[model samples]
Target: MPINADYKYIAAEIEFQKAETGAQKMKALRNMLSTAPTHKGAERLRADIKRRIAQLKDEIVKTKKQGKGRSFAIKREGAAQIVFIGLPNSGKSTLLSKLSSKKIKVADYEFTTTKPEVASIKFENIWLQAIEVPAVHEGYAEHKQGRQFLAIVRSADFVVVVVKEFRDIAKIQAELKKANILLRKTKEMIRFEQHMPHMVITWKDFNKKNLVRELWKAQHKIRVQTRAGHKIAPKPIVLQEGATVETVAKTIHKDMIRKFRFAKVRGPSAAFKDQQVGLEHVLKDTDIVEVFMK
Candidate 1:
C-alpha cells in the first residue's frame, strides 16, 4: 500500500526501514501511521496502512506467546562487557555463579534464567564484567523480548558462550549473527588515513581467555610522540597489539591516534631505535612510538 509522501511521513518511513529489530520497526510504523491525513482522498491508503499495522501487532503477540519473558534493557557496565549465550540448560547461569559471588538461579530445566544477570571477573589490575543471558530455545526463539536480549549481546565488547557437547554452535552463531554480533574474532581496531577513515575496522581470530588483558590493553591509553622528535605530552591512546604502523588508535575515543604515512617505534618490541613499522606491527607495553603525516 502507498504511504503518504509528506516530509514528516517520509521521515517515519525511513525510521521504520532503518530499524534493526522487529519490535522497533513495528513501533516506528505505528507512529508513522498515526500521522495519516484524515481526508476522504487518503482513506483507502490509510486503511491499508492500518491493516498492515494490525498484522504486525498480531505477529508480535504470537511470537511473545512462544517465549514469555519481560523485555530487558541493561546499561553496559565496567571496563568491558562480555556475555554468556547458549541453548536452554546450557549452563550459562551456572558458569556465572562459579565465576563470581553473585547469587543467580541455577536449574536443570531449560530457560531457567528468566532474565539476564551480570557478574565481575577480576583479572589483576582490571575487573571484567560478565553477563549470563537467558537460554534460547528453538520454540521461543522468535519471542518479542528475544530482540531485547540479543540487543544486549550485540552491544557487548566480547562474547563468552556456554554449550553442551551436542549443542550446535553453528545454530547459535546463526541466531546471533542476525543481530550483527560476532561469535569469534582475534582483533578489533580503528583505522585512520589522514583526513578520510574507514570507520572502526575489526580483524579476525580473537580468543576469550585473554580477553581481559586484550580488552584492557586495547582500551588503555597510549603515549604518542611525533616524527620531528617533538614531545606532544602523550595523552595515552588505547590500542591492541600488532598495530604495526598505525597501532596507537583508541577504541573508547579517550584520546586520538594520529595516522601518518609512516611511524617509528623504539622499545622492547622493536629491534632498534626509531624502527619504522606498518599498521600490522605489534606494539609492546610502555613502548615509545612516533608518527608522521608529512
Candidate 2:
C-alpha cells in the first residue's frame, strides 16, 4: 500500500484481490501501477508493484505457451483427421458417438466438452480420425485458449460444422474466418482447396452411414485392393483421386516402381476382366489390381 493512497489505488487493490485468473490479475495490477504514488516516500512501494506486474506478465506468457502446446497437440491417425466444431450442445458429442461408436460426455447443458475429444471413425475398409472441439462463440479468436483451439482446427484434414440450427452456422463460420479458415464446397460436396482445409455445414442428416460416406468423398481418396493370383488383400490401399498404378506401386514400396512391368485390373478402372495395363493407367474406387513384375 502506498502512503496516502487515494480511492482509485484502493479500488485497484480490491480488484487484485478479487481477480481469479492470471490475466485478470495482470489487468488489476496495471491499474494499480498507473494510480500508484510517485513521491520519494512511496518509491519502494512503486518498485514492488512494478516487480509484481512483471512477474504476472511472465507467468501469463508462460502459461499461454504451455496451453498452446497442450491444447493443440493432437496425433493425426487413420487416413485423415476431421474436426467437428459448433456452439455448445449442438449435437457434436452425439454425432461423434454415433459415427465413431465412442462414448463421449453428452449433456443438455453448455460447454460439456471443454477440451478436444478424439475417436476413430471407420468408413468401410478405411478409417478416419474424428475430434470434437469445444464450442465456438463470438470473439472466440480473442479468447484465452481460442487461438490454440483454432490452430488445431486449422491443421485438420477436414472440418465439419455441427449446428443445432441452420442460422447458427454463420456464428461458427465467423469465428473460423477470424482465424483465416475459409469454407469451400462443390455442389453439395465440400473439400480442401488450395491451402485451406475442407469443411461441410451440417445441421440435419446426422445419419452415421451418410456422414461417413460424405467425409470419405470430401477427402477425394480412393481405396484400391491388391490381388496376388486368386487371393486379394483384405485391407485396401487408400490413395488420392486421379491416382495411377505408378502411384499405387510407389505407395507399396519405392522399389516396386523400378521393378514394375504391368498391372492386372479387376474392378471399376478395368476395361475388361484381368485387363493388362501399364503403370500410367488411372485407378478408381474399390479397384482390385495385381501388379505383375517382369
Candidate 3:
C-alpha cells in the first residue's frame, strides 16, 4: 500500500522522540506538524505538538543554565505512550478518566489542564502509558509558550487528536497548519488470502490471482533493514494478519525497534505489488514488512 504523507509525519515524530538532541527533536516536530491532518480532529494534536516543542526549548534552556555537562532527556517507560491532544472542553479529561486509572481534573471549561499528566492503561497483557498535555490555541508555536510545550510533544509515542462533533473545523485546521501539521483522511483495507493460519512469508508478487497461494507460503524472514535507516538485521520474525507494528517488532528482536519507527506497506494498495512505505503507513492483511529500528 502507498504510504500517506500524514502517516510519515507520525512515524517521524515517534522516531524523533527517541533522539537525544534538541536539533533532531525539533526536526521531528517539524515533520509531525508538516504531515498531520489539518482538520478539527487534528487541532488537539497541533496544540499538543506545539506545547511539546515549547517544553523542549525550555529543557534546552534549563540544561544550558545548568551547564553543558548535564544531559537533557526524557526517560521513556511503558510499551507505548499515547498523547491526548485537544482544545479546552474537548472531553480529554473525560476520555482519560474512562481509559486509564489516572485521576485528572475534569471540568466544563477551557484550560483545565495546565500541565501534562500520565496514566497507565492495561490492554490484555500489555500495559500502556497515556500522557495528557495542556490545551493550545492556534499559532501557539510561534510564541514562547508554544516553544515550551514542544518538549512534551516530542516525547510521546503516539498522538490521539480529539475534537467535538460540532466545532469550527476550518478554524481548527487553520490553527494546525500554522503549527505546520498536516491532517489527512484514512480508510481501512482488508485482504483475504489462502495461507497458513498463522505464519509469515515474503513474496515478489501480490496480484489477485496469486493471493490465495501467497497465504500458504510461510517462512520466517529476517528484517535485514529498518525503516528508520538502520543497518543491523533484526531477528527473523513471523507476520500475522492484522498484527500491529509494535507486535511485529516484539517478534523480530529484543530492543531492536524501541517503538514502531514507521511501517512500509507492500502488496495490494494499488496495481503495483510489494510497495514500500514508511512506518505511519497502516498495514493491511497479508502486507509484507521490513520493520525499521527506532
Candidate 4:
C-alpha cells in the first residue's frame, strides 16, 4: 500500500513524543503504532514503537500508584524510599551495607538480590529508606523474569544505577534505553513563569543573574498573554492587602509552607520594602518574596 500519509503521521508522532508528557505521550505512541505502514521495512520499527508505548503505559500506571501512596509511605513513622538499580556484582550490597545496618547477602554473582530489601539510614534529623532491587540483565525486559524485576525499579522516587568502569559502555547504554530511564548528571533549578507553567532548565553552573533574567522574561510573556485575554495557567502570585506569609507559602509547596519563619518582600509594595516580617504579615500586589524556612 502507498505509505506517504503513514510516514507523515509517524513524523508527527515523533514530535509529539518529544513534547507531550505522561498520558499524552502514551496516547500518541499508541496512535503511531496503530497507524504505521505495514511494509516489511516499517514493520520492525512499528514493533519497536509498540513495545516502547507499552513500556511507557506501564511506567505511567506505576507512577500514579506511587504518587497516591508516597505520602503515606514516607510518613510511616520514619520512611523514605531510594531504589538501587544496576547489573550483577555492581557493589549494590556494599553500598547498602555502608549506608544502613541491614544485612544483605553480598555475592560475586549475577541475580544475588532476587528479592527487594529495605533499609533505614539516618543523617542528622533526616531518615531515608533504601530499597535494593535485583540486578537486571541484558534483554531482561523481553523475558518474564526481568519484567517483574523492573516493575519494582519503576516505583522508586530516586533511582541509582550502578555501573563499573571495566564494563562495556554499550551494554550499559542499551540497558538504560531498554529501561527507559536516563541518569541526570546535574540538578536543574525550577522556574515558574507568569503565563506558562513551571519549567526545568538544565544548567552547567549556577548563575543567579541568568536565572533571574529567564524568570523576568517569562513573567513579561505571561503579562502579554494575560493582557491579550488569553488563559494563563502559570503559578499564581496572589497578593491581598492583608494576606499572611503562611497563606502565600500554602499557595506554593505545602511541605515547607508550615515551616516558614520569615519573608523578605520586594517589588512595588512599599509597606514591605526591604523589611523582614513574620508569617502573619499581610501582602500586597507585585510583592516578590524570599521565604525563610526553619
Best by lDDT: 2
Looking at candidate 1, what is the lDDT of residue 162?
A: 57
> Judged by lDDT relative to the true structure, which candidate is superior, 1 or 2?
2
Off by over 4 Å in 4: 1-79, 166-170, 184-294
Question: What's model 4's lDDT at 214?
Answer: 40
lDDT of 3 by residue, 1-294 (tens): 112223365355555655557767887787777776677756877788789889988987887798754222344544555566676677767766766777899987788987677777654333456677777677756766554554555455455555664243445445545655534432421111121122111122223234322222222122212232332222112233444555555443334355445555454431354454443344443445555444
Candidates sorted by lDDT, best first: 2, 1, 4, 3
CA lDDT of every candidate: 0.57, 0.78, 0.51, 0.52
Per-residue lDDT for 1-294 in model 2, tens only? Answer: 332555465446645764667877889889988887888877887898899988988988888888754546877667778988889888888888988979999998988998889999999887898998899988999886888898888788788877767788778778877887766667654444444455545646766787689888888789888776666767677788999999877765445677777899989898899999999999999998887765
Q: How well does candidate 2 match the true structure in TM-score terms?
A: 0.71
Using TM-score as the measure, the top candidate is 2
Instruction: Mark the regions of model 1 whose C-alpha exceeds 4 Å error after superposition.
Output: 1-71, 139-141, 177-238, 242-282, 285-294
| Candidate 1 residue lDDT tens string, 1-294 | 122234344445445654555687787778677865667767875787688789888988898789855457655444456767778776667666755667899877777887788788765534567787877666334666777887776666656555664235667766756655444532443211121111111112233355445545544433332222444323233234444444342321112244335667887778998888765667775566655442
For candidate 4, lDDT tens digit of each residue in 76-136? 2122345666677777676666667778899877788877777776533334566777776
Candidate 1 residue-pair clash tally: 13
> Which candidate model has the greater lDDT, 2 or 3?
2
For model 1, how big is the CA root-mean-square deviation? 16.7
Error of 2 at 101 (Å): 1.1
